[model samples]
Target: MEDSRDPQFASLSVGDSAVAVLVDRATDDADVIHDIELMTCSEYSHLCLGMPSDDTGDLAMYTNNKEMHAEDRLALWPAFHRDRLAADGRRFADEGYDFVVQHQVGSRFVDYMNHVGESTFGTPMPESLSVVEKFANTATTSHYLVLHQALMERRIPRGSKILMVPAASGVVTGFLSATVSSLEV
Candidate 1:
């Protein structure tokens, strides 16, 4: 797999069963990403959701057109399954684990979600296929959430650690947002 990381400045770590991980940090080189020592596999878990960067931006902006108000933005969000997305975030929390959504900012999902909201609603919006392109980056993020929940339901202990590698920063942030919302102080 060439480790999927650049060879020149990459690092490595061998964990249980000889699991090898290569980390590509903000730096131009790879750093050895090791197990989060403070946490255990049973205490924490991660979901790596993909964040699509194609249409979410334009759609969100188009949905929240300059003329739209907060109420309007809110309206469009639910229209394009924004509630469903939020619900998905809730789902991760219900299972007692945090998520790590990774997606690039400036991309569709991030761009709009970051500002106004998702469109895909209204009387005559874009087709489902076009809307889906915006979510391409989110598949991995959602997958991680689902998997994390499943593991916790099976009694994965709190503080256990799970690794979500090579996903967009947005995905990781989404997961964290979901987790924070679900936990009680």
Candidate 2:
């Protein structure tokens, strides 16, 4: 569905006077999450990413047997991004945002350290051994953080609407890599 009310967005065209806010789901993917951090280091970019927190108590839905802990939540990043990124990418490009803000996953919990094996000299490695397994989770957090900073810097107007294009078509159409202007003009 196309959203027409919001002025601030990620990838659409902002009228000469309108303020565009480009929001990317930073924690959505590993590559894009990395990109956000690279972009941020160069200069203070105006963008925002939404960070998922336990505030909603929805984390429980992810893990059925155990209460959703921080580690469990981190594990969900890859699937979450795989599920959501394409749609969001389309939104940013189609939205013509003036600024982009997003976040990727950040540090993990101590419990997550189990992934790593026994440390050298009887000391245990602080983190998981197969950190690659956690990359998606951490990346998700990174994206969220980067995007959050971006949003805070360039706050979108309260009433600005967001347009989210469906994912199935975006993936089918090869729209993921295209920038905001590249979308159907």
Give the deviation of candidate 2 from the true structure as CA RMSD: 19.3
CA-lDDT, candidates in order? 0.27, 0.25
Stretches of model 2 off by over 4 angstroms after superposition: 1-68, 83-185
Listed per candidate, the RMSD to the true structure in angstroms reads 19.3, 19.3
Give the per-residue lDDT of model 1 (tens digit) for 1-185: 13322221111111102222232343321222222211112111122112232433321101111222234332343333334445456321233222222222124543444233223322222111111233333333333433334454543333323223222211112122211112111
TM-score of 1: 0.18
lDDT score for residue 53 of model 2: 28
